[model samples]
Target chain A: MTGHEERFDSVAAYALGALPPAEAAAIKEHLQTCALCREEYAYLRPAVTAVAYSAEACTDAGSGAVAVSPLLKSRIMKRVRSEAASREAARRIWPAYALAAACVAIAIVTGLTDLSLNRQNDAQRQTIADLAAPDARRHFFAGGEVVTHGGRIYIAMRNLPALPAGRVFQAWTLARGATRVAPSSTFAPGSGGVAVVALPEAATNIAAVAVSVEPYGGSSQPTTKPIAVVRI
Target chain B: MERVRLRDADAFEALYDGYHRLVYGVAMRVLADPGAAEDVTQAVFLKVWSSPALFQGGSFGAWIARVARNRAVDLARSRSSHGESQLDETLVVEEDLEDTALANIDGERVRKALARLPVEQREPIELGFFGGATQDQIARQTGLPLGTVKTRIRTGLRRLRNALEDALTV
Candidate 1:
């Protein structure tokens, strides 16, 4: 046998009090063939004997064989019986739990696709909510981008009402100098209606924020009046 | 001794019969006052019966000892609020804990002697107090290397034996 297999056999024999039984009686043993294992056992025997003997010295009632009285055993058996009953009760309700879990999974998946595209748009809504101080999530940042940070205005629109095929929506900052609107973000109806039009931060005393429906591509100038506006 | 997870008369009786001494012993060992120990023992078994799931897959003795230990510690702290001193070291806990509790059975000189060893040596001595959890459980719980845990327990035990023997004499 391999060295490891031989070594483990010796220790196992030592642990179980069987080393002498095999060497003294068993015929055709490996230890009889190997002298090294014999020599190791000679030294290991005393060490093992000393260890086995040490546990014997400890003997007070506090040290060994703690008694479990019959009364306690009866109490334990009663608890087990009642707990078994409740576990049966829980097993009976498992079908309802499975059904509830399925419903929750379905709702979670349906909510996923709308999530990614709306995440940034949602953040803009959060900014508005921050300003509005809305108590609820639905009332906050409805949706939009920073139209004015410092003295520059930028607007990003997503999922807004689209123009006829080849048409686009034009957005305006509507401040004093930005009264004359410029070509802003391009939005396709079927494709994602999302983009930012340059709306530079102009006068500090701005009027409002607005989006206007324009022609194919966009209006060379202002055409339709702003569809939605919030007076700042 | 008493059945903790269920409301059954025999279970209650058995639990009361078997563990009353352990619970009382733990409380007495930790709290020292007879009245406080008895009260803590009553409260511990009451909770044990109500929350049986807390001991799921765990040893009954370990679970009961923990409950007794916790309740006793709480009672000891409460007593301190009433102007009593903190629990003394000589409190004689039931044998189950006191047997394995090297510090409790032999006394704190062993613990103090243990504390004198390096941190690496002191930890395995503490591990012996964990009654039922395996060495691997301790390694996983403490996030220590597996070999390190084994070595510390073995090497530290040897040192503790040498030191504790001397300390016991002192």
Candidate 2:
């Protein structure tokens, strides 16, 4: 109430989450400069929470129409348990995952076989998602969200087939001798194909992308040649 | 899970354990039909079991409500297409507004109470409860004056709170 009308209106709009992106950004910048509007924004939180909670309370508490059978209850509980078990297993397998990751890195670097440093660079630029069998041509990667919105690579591959599980798939970065394999990446295909792995955002200098099939859970690095390679 | 996946026994059982009634209540309140409510309830639980991953964000109640709202909204659209229908004109399932939240506030009861509200107030409430729209989005979609919509929400909340309070006490 410091006689700042525009500031007041902006705060209200922000509380309602109705401001356009540009306006929202402007208001955010303005608030940093104005103490009055900042205080009001803080005061609006409780009201928003109250509005949300009140709406949720409207359903009737006594309706004979909805009834659950005993047989059905047990079924849902079992599914939850199994999913819980799998999450636990994933958590425990990290050490093995780390060791395997190391071996793959050495193969690509030491073997001096493939100088596909450009593959990693291309991954960032083209935002390549998944790799498939060389002969099998598919634009998008297998089991990945192809975001046509931006030029960045944002792959989220989960549970990809393990290298040792047969067939090697190595992720590489393009630069110089200091080539480092992506540590954040994971691969293991379940019934739905490997778990999704999200690669780094796109950058300039990216030249190529490749995925080679190697030993179980894949080798610490590429064993021979790449089954998939694309020049960006 | 394998067994549950086969027959959806676990998800169905969750449906049986009061979650169904609550979801059914939400759908019926919005769509106002016994058969449609039942259909939505079944679909929500079925989806939950079929792809538990879809609603795996920690807040189970919010996830369930979202699924129920989508089904209800779809039903509402079809009913609207028929024209001049009571927005809440689905089959009347019996209901009592008063019942404890965890004790016996069945789904239909909540739905029936929702049906009693005016659309101006009810639409936003439904969307928020169902997670389809934020308060501001609801105002924009309904074309109600923002202050007026907010007021209606406040009043609606008071009424809903009264009903819930009675239920919890009884």
Best by lDDT: 2
Model 2 chain A poorest 10 in a row by lDDT? A129-138
Write candidate 2's Cα lDDT for B1-170 as tens digits: 33333333444464446355456656665665666666666656656654544543333443455456555765666567775332232321111111122233433455566567777666665554443344567678788776666566555644554554444422
Candidate 2 segments exceeding 4 Å error: A1-232, B1-18, B33-63, B78-150, B162-170
Give per-residue CA lDDT, model 1, range A191-217, as digits (tens). Answer: 334443334345255556666677766
Give the range where candidate 2 chain B is weakest over 10 consecutive residues by summed lDDT.
Answer: B92-101
What RMSD value applies to candidate 1? 23.4
Model 2, B125: alpha-carbon shift in Å? 6.0
Per-model TM-score, in order, reads 0.26, 0.36
For each candidate in turn, the interface RMSD (Å) is: 16.1, 10.2
**DockQ of all predictions against the true structure, Cα-based:** 0.04, 0.08
TM-score of 1: 0.26
Docking class of 1: incorrect
